[model samples]
Target: MDKNYYITTPIYYPSARPHMGHAYSSIVADFFARFKRIDGFNVHFLTGTDEHGLKIQRAAERKKIDPQTFCDEISQTFRDLSKTLNLSNTDFIRTTEERHKKTVQHLWNELEKNDDIYLSKYSGWYSVSDEAYYSDEEISEKENVKIAISSGSSVEWIEEESYFFRLSKWQDELLKYYEKNPDFISPKSRKNEVISFVKGGLKDLSISRKAFSWGIKVPNSQDHVIYVWLDALTNYLSALNYPDTNDELFKKFWPASVHLIGKDILRFHSVYWPAFLMAAKIPLPKKVYGHGWILSGDEKMSKSKGNILDPLDIIEIYGLDPLRYYLIKEVSFGNDGNISQDRLEDCINSDLANNYGNLCQRVTAFAEKNCSSLVPDNTKFNDEDLVMLNKFTDNLDLIRTEIDNQNINYYINFIVSALFEANKYFNDQEPWKKKDDKDRLNTIVYTSLEMIRKISFMLYPIIPSSIEKALKIFNLNIDAINLESIAKHDYLISGKPINKIDILFKKIEKKHD
Candidate 1:
């Protein structure tokens, strides 16, 4: 059997437009999925909208549309984002879909059969904004109204007939699991926070909400709707055609390799999600990485705050790959990153346009001018030439390790730095000055072209279209753009005329109004 690697972005709640947060998770998942595919794994990348929730129900009410209509409209936006952002997702599963509803119901039934689900009257401070029931300690008073302390969302005290999952009963088991698999949750800080929350003790989770009817119906119960998190979390399984674990996709990709989620939802994924799986006799996903938010200034983005940065707007201004590169390069995966327009311009102008793109233009332009727009054969090897060539070969393992660890900044920063070194090598050699010495110039151009080829392969996942265009200059195809192909040098055919290529990244002018 081929090694299978399955990864998922948490199904985004579509109470509003998809923003940078939604884009961040999906992009990271896409990046890893592409990396794993190139690393020779059978990869399944899943991302979609979480449409069934009180938040959506209320948003739909205000919009004067049925929940499904509201969901469909918003869901389409997220689907479009996947395309606009160049995400190579294998599947996009919405909670409102029949396939997903069936899987969620099946899982609920399994939990009920195990006696881990029971009826109860649920009364607590509930954040409709959060779609979560919070204990008194987790809520605080603000302007004579209760709110969740963590999210500062308004909460209401309500009583409802509900189905409760025996989440508290598995406290010890969850602790043991965390201890045994220290890496089950990532970024050490988020893992510690989860451990502390579980250690402080868990209360049984109300898995059904009777207050609203805009969610997945509880199995065999019409009065109650299955909690949105429960319905939404199962998307990872549903996308694989679960309940029929005998299906080829399910059999091949069960127990997802990782659940890439936002840090705010860490408890739901790390605590409630695992306990539910344990109760249902289903294997847990191998890992859950709760990454931090992309803040729009000092504050976390909220519609009420009028601070949500629409990703489409950014893409429109900067194009897709620049936006992708900025997010991955600027944001520390497990910590909140404040994005500013100025910062974005500086990053793109310095890294993509000046450093990487300028190097490509100069070297390829040199080849065009002197080497007859054809790839030249290396004539002589010098210490600098070998060192410059070795940069790509020597760093392959380290790059693989960084990608595996989800240390994206390190991986991206290394690539940019290597390109800078290549630029320095170009300056030191001065291929333009050596035009009279055809042999030396050919050797320099050939060596530089190989370096560009290697970096382009590494860059394909992050900025696919731009890198594809860059590699096309050397007549490389998508099929030949993998680690194994780039592992060896001298792959570029000598005397093959290169294709005409445009500038990869045009410098962005900063706007100050």
Candidate 2:
């Protein structure tokens, strides 16, 4: 068992400000990274901006600024977002960065050296918005304008002398690789789509764009800039110091554990990325998980749609952890999910305030009054007590299995169910009624406290700040959290003083006009 884990959110395009979709991907990746870290793996988490593309060039031109200047300003918003969202990413690499440029050019030279690349002329329908080349079958005319049928984004005919990657040559090899490693593309549905597309056919890819000057230059071909997808995909490698494959960072986490991406880019990551790695003689990532979009209403969030949900606004209203919890628990991973304000408010009030927060506050307040604010000593475990406590120890392995499979919905559902059970257990036992029987009262308090510790440990990855506050009732900090400790029934010290914590969540009151 290797304990090294590497994960990445697709480096975002900086043509627009960060959106809920960007935040969702980063938060999900951060959740996995945090889980792996607490599970005893050395984790490397990467995210950043894809600053070079036709869309970015046009956006910069519209702003009346140079591409680099535009990138610097726009890219900072993403960096700020990583902080605002409380992401635990280890590195943020921009395509315009010199180090990333070095890695991209190095990959290019390697492909060229391997005869996987050739100088060629390309004529196709190109979508500047998607930064993708579409085949005739993929394009449809809408309102007298040609658009990519899949994305609904307008495309233009382009003819350019450029460099091409031998994607067609690797078509059969890629299919064989996918067949050999069935889990390479996740969620079963996405895998089927990729396999069917590859089986249909693969065209040689255009790897350079002579029209855009805002990207990494082809190694020896100064007149051409590398294709945006190729340059952007290389960020995963560049962040690890590739080309110097023997470097410690590169050697330990080369083949990434997973690349978390949006479904719209599934073709690029699942097909082109793996093919590029194979052609360059580098190991492919373990998995490419293409998650669904975060829809604003019934439609996917887009600027043109005027329905993009700003995560920052949601965080402002509900708080970060609540937002994190809502997204993680409510959204069905690998399926498009809509964000509704009413549902978010309900989640914050029901799940956060009533269930988990009330449990922590009630138990701690009871302990303060009855047990002198100290962790109580239990006399003996009753069947009921053992049953409640065993829920965690029993499912430890199952939780780990689900996390490994990226079964986020399962993991979150387990937590929600556990929280519900913990609340019910506390209510049923009636510790306040057994005040005269000190041992029984102490036992119930001890059991309740232990349940809190276990559930808080499981939740540390999702609602970290709130969990940090909740754990302080046990006088524990972030560094004290560990997944392995959850299996221990008596992890909390008997005589340790429990600190008081502020309300974890203020119930959002409903308004009646």
TM-score, one value per model: 0.96, 0.99
Give the local distance difference test score of model 1: 0.87
| Global fold similarity of model 1 (TM-score) | 0.96
lDDT tens digits, residue span 400-502, model 2: 9999899999998888898899999989999989988899899999999999898898899999999988988998899999999888888877889997689
Using TM-score as the measure, which candidate wins? 2
Model 2 local distance difference test score: 0.92
Which segments of model 2 are wrong by more than 4 Å? Answer: none
Q: lDDT at 302 for candidate 1?
A: 80
| Clashing residue pairs found in predicted model 2 | none
Worst 10 residues of 1 by lDDT: 478-487
How far in Å is the alpha carbon of 47 misplaced in model 2? Answer: 0.6
Clashing pairs in 1: none
**Model 2, position 432: C-alpha lDDT score:** 89
